[model samples]
Target chain A: MVRVDGKGSGALVEIRSLDKKYRRGGEEIDVLRGLNLDVDAGEFIAFMGPSGSGKTTLLNLIGGLDTPTSGAVRIGGDEISRLSGRKLAAWRSRHIGFIFQMYNLIPVLTAFQNVQLPLLLTNLSKAERRKHVEAALDLVGLSDRMRHYPRQLSGGQEQRVAIARAIVADPTILLCDEPTGDLDRAAGDEILDIISRLSKEYKKTIFLVTHDPIAAKRAGTLLHLDKGTLLECTADGLFACKPEDAGK
Target chain B: MAIPLEYNVRSVFIRWPSTLVAVLGIAGTVAVFVVMLAMAQGFQAMLIGGGSRDNAIVLRGGADSEMMSAITLDQVRVIADAPGVARSASGDPLVSAEVVVVGAFPLLATGSDANVQIRGLSPIVLEVRPNARIVEGRFFQPGLTELVVGRNVSGTYAGFKLGSTVEFGGGRWTVVGVFDAGGSSYDSEVWCDAVVLNQVFKRPENIFQSATARLASPESFQAFKDAATSDPRLTVDVFRETAFYAEQSRMVSTIIRVLGFIVAIVMGVGAVFAALNTMYSAVASRSAEIATLKALGFSPASVVASFVAESTVIALAGGAVGVLASLPFNGFTTGTMNWSSFSYLAFAFRVTPEIVASGLVFSLLMGIVGGLPPALRAARLPIIVALREL
Candidate 1:
């Protein structure tokens, strides 16, 4: 197994000395402290950690949703941390897709419209958008349920629709934060299967944050984040309770 | 990229109770604005319509209205002989020296004493005011105590109907005729023989209040005004009748407009707060949705525009309903005191296209003012914090 300590060759995402801090009434809390990692394209990396371990914070920085307090984050050679507001948004639309645990689909829009959201940023014709949306929905095996709204769809189905939305724009990277945290075990596995397929078949660079080890087992590489520090870990080491047996 | 309009529309209905309160609030504000301004428009229209561009009115130089002006028969003669005074085919000047006075009359509906204008003019009154016609009976005969009531006066005041005897100016006069003044402010007056009215009212027979003269041409007004004012023997001012009436309407119309705006603004503030509450509630309730949209790379401007558009649409709907509500009041006859004449003038509510358009624009302004703060708040919401709400 390869480590992700900023030494990967031809890495698609590079994080160097990244730090994030929050101020809480005269107290400065360090969420991420001098975190460094490198991830190559098409890698399905699952990040398992406790609450406040900065796993989601790292994903947010990589996705350009937040800026690190210190150091640089470069994705595909573009130093996204330096991008201005509108530029960062444009970069995000073009490159990053997000999937959340709650299946954050707009309640008002149908499944098809939800998937077509990112495509609206492009200058594609309406028919072209329709074609892409249908293909993405079909990939999630929800082609027949395109017209159903979020409330009409079941929990697992809503997550699948969210997955369709994430992939419809064919983004370069998928930043999924606890995408299956609210789901049953079967639904969780189903979401992990789609995410694994997205990485393998579409060659999408995936960064998944999850606490479920069974979900993390589907990843090509598994890492543990403990107190804002990242370390390589195996599936066997994942289930161990002892502090020394946790990660290498 | 812009957010889809369908999203905002569905959200509005999905949360309909608050939307309804906002809509009704805006609707009430617009309705009040429309009705109040329509009243001003109607009063101004009636008074302004009473005068013709080709007629000139001679009044005392310092007087603001006929009620305040006093012109003797001798001065009227000089005014009639002034340059640019039109003449009939018989070579007589088309002038009518009139005495204007206010009489207290019992209102038919409320039985309260209200002021009614009484005009005493020469028999040539109909010729000078071509719009006035005997709609029900013949005009009053000269040198007689017969009275001819205007259509509005006969209908609004007690004992002013045709053939009814009414006491005024220390005499019992018979209502022998009813005239229509072509929907002008003159509809609120009564006319009788100048000599008879002066005799009963105890004024000097030679004294009159104003003289209305038809001009040879509308362009002859300046010459007539110069001629009347320059005459040393006559202490009088002359104005194109249309201009005089337009000026007379200014005080009442301005008061109505100012009062209307003050009331509308007062109500508009409440409407704005209602809109703010609705939008803030919307933003708070949709925090997760907003975060999802932001994460999808919808710009802050797009989010702001979407929320503002929703508010504007709601306000526009309210405006449409308000306009519809005001339409029924159009041409519905009502009366209010004319400050210049100091008498009740009957006129209809005039909801012109311009007034309706102004109301809609006013509501649109309210929507923008009310929605902007909440929209900006929604736009500036941090994506991570809102996502955590999910």
Candidate 2:
């Protein structure tokens, strides 16, 4: 197990004593409690947990989609958890790119248009935006499929399009929740290899949530979340955990 | 940032069934609204167009219309001598004493009996109403049972065609001519010699229903009215013919307006509900799509604007169709009873530009009302929850 000996002062993402509570029918459920973590830039972290283990919730909090009930989440020196909805949305556009398991590419738009979505928020001219979208599609190996719609592509191709959309704006971080959950083994491996290249070459800080231990092994840092706290894992990650204690 | 317009447009085309339902509902409502308003406009135009600003009608005091007034020949002569009366080329005051009576005639289209205005006009009538010109044959001669059918009523009533004989006023009056009255209400009347009509109807030849006189100018109507009413020998009310006809049109116009509004409101409510149902369904079906847009950093206001624009486009399409559907009724002539004169008045439907504009504005308003709530719902939906939706 790799453990830090000091506070991460120059870390890209800093979480301190974070708590998240959800009220359901007058009952307050603590989804996350007193979570502390520091992630450096260009680190590829994989979070493996069973359902209701708060992995997605923790990712949401870091992406500024949800506010923590207590404590602070600082990204690039800004307290994102304290931002309002509009400010957070602006921040997300500038810094965070999300890829969902369902590959939520707008069904009505072609692959090129879908990748161009986030760039619309920028002051980029039409030609500049087209250049960036083309480069992103090229990176994801979807340059030839730019004119096809989501329904026209297979699950792997749709997820590749979603990836192109995420990186077209050159965001500071990528938050992918089950990016390959719907794909078969070969498709999933291809997606993971592309994601690894983004981290190594583009230096984009990526946080991936997964249920597969093989997927977790591809990350530079592997951590397991249970109940409301994260546990460190060895270099082999899930292989080091007891079978029931790993993904469960 | 706003979502691209193509997203909303393609969504509309992709789900054309619901969009079509909304479009047709708005179209039907606008069609009914435009046609109803056209009816009122046509009726009012025909009546108000009958009068000239440079002329005055002298009626017995307290009579609102010519049919309700009875003035003696001596009173008509006194009115002719009024200070502001215009003189003709022969230096005679331009005054015409006319008698009006309602005759029962069968409608050509329905064969049902209807009360038609029969006006017994003196020789000076054509000069006083210069807009009335013989279009088919010459005017009737004095002391003869000859009639001139108006252009609007020429073939609308049985036996009113040119050269046809119809019995009225205890005589067989021959239809000798057809006159065009510049699309005025006078185009709905039959004209004959006053003396001949008085004799056949057994009324005194010295008595006439009203007298029309040309004023020196439009500005001289008040002076003429003052002169006529101030004469002690004549008990008459003088009105600028334009003002009198305007007042005569008020009752029917108001009825038509009220009826049109009532029908439009009822149908408008249904159209709005249909729009609401269609938009709500669109929002429900597009929950995931909307969530993805929001997650992509599109502002809530932009989402709202996009959806509202889609709804407006649908409504405007419907409005255009409605306008086109109502155009064919323009100038389609029909007749209805004039409550003031108790005579059948013929007019055509007038689908004016103003009514078309109003119909479009009305549909636009419906689109906004129907779209706002569902758009807000779509905007306020929690992104994560909606993302999970099917």
Give the per-residue lDDT digits (tens) of candidate 2, residues B52-105.
998899899999888889999889888888888888899999998899899999
Model 2, TM vs. native: 0.90
Give the C-alpha miss distance for residue A68 in model 2, angstroms.
2.9
Give per-residue CA lDDT, model 1, range B16-61, as digits (tens). Answer: 9999999899989999999999999999999988999999998898
Residues A54-134 of candidate 2 have per-residue lDDT tens digits of 999999898877889998899999999888777877899899998889999889999999999999999999999999999
Worst 10 residues of 2 chain A by lDDT: A238-247
Each prediction's whole-model lDDT (CA): 0.89, 0.87
- What lDDT is obtained when candidate 2 is compared to the true structure? 0.87
Per-residue lDDT, model 1, residue B354, is 97
TM-score, chain A, candidate 2: 0.92
Candidate 1's displacement at residue B155, Å, is 1.9
TM-score of each: 0.92, 0.90
Q: What's the true lDDT of residue B2 in model 1?
A: 88
For model 2, the stretches where C-alpha displacement exceeds 4 angstroms are A1-7, A24-27, A233-248, B58-62, B70-93, B204-207, B214-240
